[model samples]
Target chain A: MLDVADVHTYYGEGYVLQGVSLTVEPASIVAVLGRNGVGKTTLIRTVIAFTPARRGRVMFEDRDITRWPSYRIAKAGMGLVPQGRRIFPSLSVRENLEIAQRAAATDIAEPWSLGRVLDLFPALAERLRNGAGTLSGGEQQMLTVARALVGNPRLLLMDEPTEGLSPHIVAEMKKLVVGLRARGMAILLVEQNLAFALDVADRVHVMDKGKIVFGGTPAELDADETIKKTYLGV
Target chain B: MTFWIINTLNGLSLAMILFLLAAGLTLIFGLMHIINMAHGSFYLLGGYIAITAIRLTGGFIFGAIVAVIAIAVIGAIIQRLFLARLYKQEMRQALLTLGLLFIVADIAFFTWGGDPLLVPQPPLLQGAVHFWGIVYPLYRVFLIGCGLVIAFCLWAFLERTTLGAIVRAGMDDEEMVRGLGINVPLVFTGIFALGAALAALGGVLGGPLLGMFPGADFEVVLLAFVVVTVGGLGSIRGAFLGSLLVGLVDNFGNAWFPQLSLFTIFVPMVIVLALKPTGLMGRV
Candidate 1:
């Protein structure tokens, strides 16, 4: 479980995330839906300490990780697949996975190892020797996910994992998310894919202008067509 | 044919030194994005340290070890204390590190007068072997072997080890690497130190061939820049290949046309940039 409260983030002088607060329960997939440039990625970055929160606290498993460095936060069991699929372009598919591979103490049962990750994303295994940058968009996205999963993270922060993918790849990504949740991985998903969010997320928190405007079960958000149309434009 | 052979050997020797310097510069710059103008200063400092150590220890091996270790520690301190503060901003890093080069140069001059410093070759490596009846310095040949061995070892470290994997990852995306449970800052500091140590090693090995002097840092640094640029920014393979090309061209240029030698050195870089832009072995 992870807790972020009153986190304020800035890009240069302008305030981007103004006192945003949220919590993700254990083994749950929490979707944060927001319009473009609505601080969704900023929230994710702040939690992972890529862009540290100016004023707020981020707690992971009852430990205050607010001031912790990005690497320490990651070592504390948080994995992030950033907005862009920032795979090592020159490195092979296999090399990308192995690069972020660290054996932490609290690795899950049937832990996400190199072999397991490859099995989960078989396309990656097929292109093991191929450069990561040469992979298709879907393949790159899958490799990005596999790269993070190989780190054996307790809390996975996926920012727009299914973005810019074909429908088939999108469905496959949804299945992958559901499967991860079934395997008891806590995911803080920031996504623009509304129907996909509804399908995979147990709880939904709709963010607007840096604050969570809506937080409820998926069904509740689905029923509120006015709110969805107004905020998500779906 | 004999003249060509000698020129080729000279080119190889020059290439080896350039590779040693550029390999470190490329890695440190590519991974950390810090344009350390003081990188050549480390090379100069390494030579000075080796000279002093050899004087005290009276053994080349022991002296080499002392010199490498000392400068590596200094490299780490520089990264932690100065360069770390200027990450992602090349202009600031360039200005700061360039200033550091002057400071380090002045320190060396103050410590060991302005005259050219002589570095005696280890006795075991002093004798020459006749190649095509041409007398080649034993130290120069040793330097070639040392450079190749170091290059091979570096390739192995970057390709075979876990730490190297992290460095490769850090090079690809430093922020994401940090988010993946790897200590990126620690990796940055280590890489910087390793790179600095390599540059220093080149300086020590090359000191005997090219005497250690106050302006030597500037000379080597210019060569390093040309090598790195010609090879492509952030490409080790490119750096290696570029160094060979530059080394050959430089040697031949000087030998064949001494009047245009200085100008000819920058020609390959111009052509490479004009033709490939990304370099011969560089990635987009």
Candidate 2:
């Protein structure tokens, strides 16, 4: 489980996230939803400590990780499939998977080896030795998720994992997330896809202008047309 | 025919030394994106330290080992304390490293004085031998052998090891590597030390050829940059291939056409840039 409290993040001189707060229960997928540029990516980055909070606390399984370096945060069983598919363009699929393998606590008993990753994304297995950059946008997205899963992270933070993917790939990605949650991997999902979020997220937290505007189950979020229209702008 | 054979031999040997120096420089530049103007200082310091160690220990191997270890530790500290903060900023990194180079160069001048320090060869490797009816310097041969071994080892390191895989990944996207739970600082420090050690070893081996002189640091550093620029920055394989091209060109150019030797080095560089622009190995 991951917990963030009153976290303030800044980009250079501009305040990006003002006292943003959220939480994820163990083995649960929590979606942080909002309209475009509502600090969704910033919030995910702050939790992962890629963008360290200038104020407030981030706790991973009850450990105060506010000031932990990005790498250390990851080593503590958190994996991030960052905003874009930031795969090493020059590296092959196998090499990308090899690089993410750490002998962490959550890495043990994982079915997601290089083989399984390839199995999950069969198209990736076909392009094993191909340059990652040459992969289609959909394949790149799959590689990104498979890359994180190879790290065997306890908590996976996906920032707009479906952004720019084909509809078919996006559907496959949704199925993949559902499968991952079934395997009991905790995930903090950040997305703009309202229907997708409602389907996959056990609970939804709607963010607006650097603050959480609503926190409830997906059904509750679906029923609140007023909240959705105002903050999510559905 | 004999002249041709001797020239070829001479060029290959020179290529070996260039590879030793350029490989480290390229790796440092590629992974850290720091120009590391002080890398040549590490080379100069390695030679000076080796000279001192040789005098004290009275053995070439002992001196070489001590010098490399010392330089590696110094390199790690410098990266951890200084260059680590200036990552991703090219101008500041270049200026800061250049300042460090001046400091090291000044210290070398103050301690060793302006004269070229004598580096006496150990008894076993002091003499030349007749190979294929051509007399060659034993040290040059030793340099060629050592260069090949080191190059092979580095290749194996980059290709076969888990750490090397991580390094390759880091070279591609450092943020992604960091996001995967890798201690970027530790990897950076390790690589910085490795690059420094390689340069130091080259310094010791190449010391006799390029004696411990006042501006030796600048000269060798210039050559290393030329090598990197010609080969493409950050490619070890590029460094190897580029060094060979440079060494052969410089050597053959001087012998065949002394008037154009210097220009000969730049000619291939010009060609490479005209075509690739990023050099032979540069990804970005």
Candidate 3:
């Protein structure tokens, strides 16, 4: 479980997340939906302590990790699939996964082994010897997800995993998300894709101008038209 | 034919020393973006320590090992105490390291008494090789071999090992590396220490030929910089190529055009910068 309370984050002089708050229950997907530049990425970065919060607290598994270093935060069960599929271009796909492979937290029932992960993405198995950069967009996205999965995180922070992905790839990613949740891993997903987020998210929070403006179940969000248009623009 | 063989070998031997020194400089710059002005001072101090060790221990191998390990320890200390606090603050890092450069040089002068000393060669590597009427100092050949072995080891480690992948990944994206639960700060210290160790090794190796002199550190440091610049920063291949190019130019220039010896290496560097701007093999 992860709780971000009244978090405030800044990039240099520009305040990105201003008193924003959210919570992700264990084994559930909590989607934060917003249009461009609503601090969605910053929210993710703040929780992971990349662009750390200037105020408030970030609690992970009931432990305060607000001021922890990024690596320490990651090792404490926070794995990130960053916005860009920033795989190490020169490294082989196997190397990319190998560099990130880590033991799962004690709470995790079934950890992701290289063999299991390869089973999840068979396309990657054949291309393990090939360079990551040489992978197609879908394969690269798969590699990015696979790389994070290998870290054995309890809380996976996915920042726009579907961005620039094809429709089928996005759908495949959606399936992957549900499958991961079924395996008992919590995910905090930031998205601009309203339909994709609404379909998979157990709970949804729509953000606008560095603050969460709407919160409720997927059905509740579907019934509310004005909130969707105002924040997510359809 | 004889003239060419001798000069080429001489140039190559000197280039090996330059490669050892500049290789470390470039890797640090690549990963940490730290200018590390104290690098030359580390070299100078290493030579002093090496000659002293050789004199006392009566073993070139022991002297070289001591010099390397000492600098590696000192490098780690500096990284932990100073550089960790000064991350991404390039100006501050430069100023701080520049101060360290002067401090280290002064310390060496006080300890070593500003006297020139030659590193004693091992008995096994003392004689010259005679092949087809070509005479070459065995030590120069040994130096070339040493450089090549180091280069090969570095290449293999970087391209073949998992730790090397983490390092390469760090060089590409630090945030991504840290997000994978890796101890990036620890990697930083290791890399900085490794860089300093290589420079120290260069000092020990170059001592026999260049001799340990007071102002030689600054002089050779400039050549190392030129190699890094001309080869492109942060690339090992670039450093090796750059060293050979600079070495040959300097050696040939001093031999034939002694009047323009100062400008020979710089001329090629300027031309490379003007044409490529990032050096020959630099990524950016």
Candidate 4:
């Protein structure tokens, strides 16, 4: 479980995330939905401590991890699928996986492994030896998810995982998230695709101007037309 | 024909020595993106330390071992104490190393005096060998063998092992590599030590041929720059091939056009840059 409370993040003097709070329960997906540049990505970054909050608290499995280095936060079971699918372009897909692979967790009965992840994304399995840059856009997206899965983390922070992905691949991604939850992995997804977020997320929070404007169940979000019109514009 | 054969041998030996120095320089540049102006200083110090160690133990083996380990430890210390603070600050790190270069050079000059000391060869590697009635120094052959073996090992390490995979990945995106829960700083220190050890090894092997003297660091480092620039940054094959090209040209140029010897080593680099700014095998 991951909990972020009243987090304020900045870049130099520019305030990016202002008093943001969210919680991702075990074996569930919590998505933050908003239009572009509404601090959705910043929320993910702040939670992961990629850009540490100047004023706030981040509790991962009950430990205060704020001000810790990004690597330490990651080693403490936070795997980040960063925006833009930043895979090592020169390395082979196999090498990319190998570089991020970790020992499986003891508590989990069926831990994620290279073979297991490859089974999930067989397209990546075929191109294991090829350069990752040679992968198609959709395959690269798959590689990023698979790369994070191989890390065997307790929580995965996915930043716009469906961005630039085709509708067909996006459907596959939705299934993948549900499958991961079935295996008992917590995920915090940041997205701009309102319909996709509402479909996949158990709890949806709409963000605006560095603040969470609305939070509720997907059904409640669907029920409220006023919040949708004012913030979501849809 | 005999003259050409001897000249080729000379070039090959020189190529091996250059490879030793530039290989470390290129690796440090490739992985850390630090210019490491003190690389030449390490070479100078390694040669001086080896000579002292040889004199103390009266054996080349002791000198070589001490030189490599000492320089490696020193490199690790420097990285931890100073360079670690400047992580991702490439310009500041380079400036700090540039300052270290002068300080190290001064210390070596103060201790070693102005005289040029040729590194004594190991007892086992001493003397000449005759094959097909052509005589050659045994030490040069050993140096060439060492260079070739190291080249193969480095290539294998980078292309085959998982740790090497982490290194290659870090070269592309260090931040993401960190996000993978890897202790990247520890890896960087380990690599810095390895690179320093290689340069020290070069110093030990190059002692008998190039001789250790004041300002020798600049001269050797200049050649290393040309080699890395011509071959490419962050590429082992590039460094090896670049060394060969520069080595042969410098050898031939010195013999053929003594006055233009400096131009000979640099000409290839300029032409390579003009054609392909990334060098022969540079991926980044």
| TM-score for candidate 4, residues paired by index | 0.97
Q: How high is each candidate's interface RMSD, in Å?
A: 1.3, 1.2, 0.6, 1.0
As a whole number from 0 to 100, the lDDT of residue B169 in candidate 3 is 87
TM-score of chain A of each: 0.97, 0.96, 0.98, 0.98
Q: List candidate 4 segments past 4 Å from native.
A: none
lDDT of 2 by residue, B1-284 (tens): 78887777788887886787798888888899888888889888999999999998899899889989999999999999888887777889889989998999999999989999856577788889797778878877888888999999998998777788788888888877999988988999999999999888878888877778778788788877888887888889888888888888888899979998768888988998899887887775
Q: State the weakest 10-residue window (summed lDDT) of model 1 chain A.
A: A102-111
Pairs that collide, model 2: none
| Segments of candidate 2 deviating more than 4 angstroms | A104-112, A115-119, A230-233, B256-262
Task: Candidate 2: give its CA RMSD in angstroms.
Answer: 2.2
Q: On residues B1-284, what C-alpha lDDT tens digit does candidate 1 reach at each position?
A: 88898888888888898888999899987798777789889989999989999998888888778888998999999999988887787899899989999999999999988999966679999988786678877777888888788888888888777777778777777887788777788989999999899888888888888879999998998999899888887777878888889899999999999999878989878988999898887654
True contacts kept of 1: 0.82
Better of 2 and 4 by DockQ: 4
Model 4 residue A106 CA deviation in Å? 1.2
Please state how well chain A of candidate 3 matches the true chain A, as a TM-score: 0.98
Candidate achieving the largest DockQ: 3
Candidates' lDDT values, in order?
Answer: 0.87, 0.86, 0.91, 0.89
Off by over 4 Å in 1: A104-107
Better of 2 and 3 by lDDT: 3
| Native contact fraction, candidates in order | 0.82, 0.84, 0.86, 0.80
In order of lDDT, best first, we have 3, 4, 1, 2
Residue B89, candidate 2: Cα error in Å is: 3.1
RMSD of each: 1.6, 2.2, 1.3, 1.4
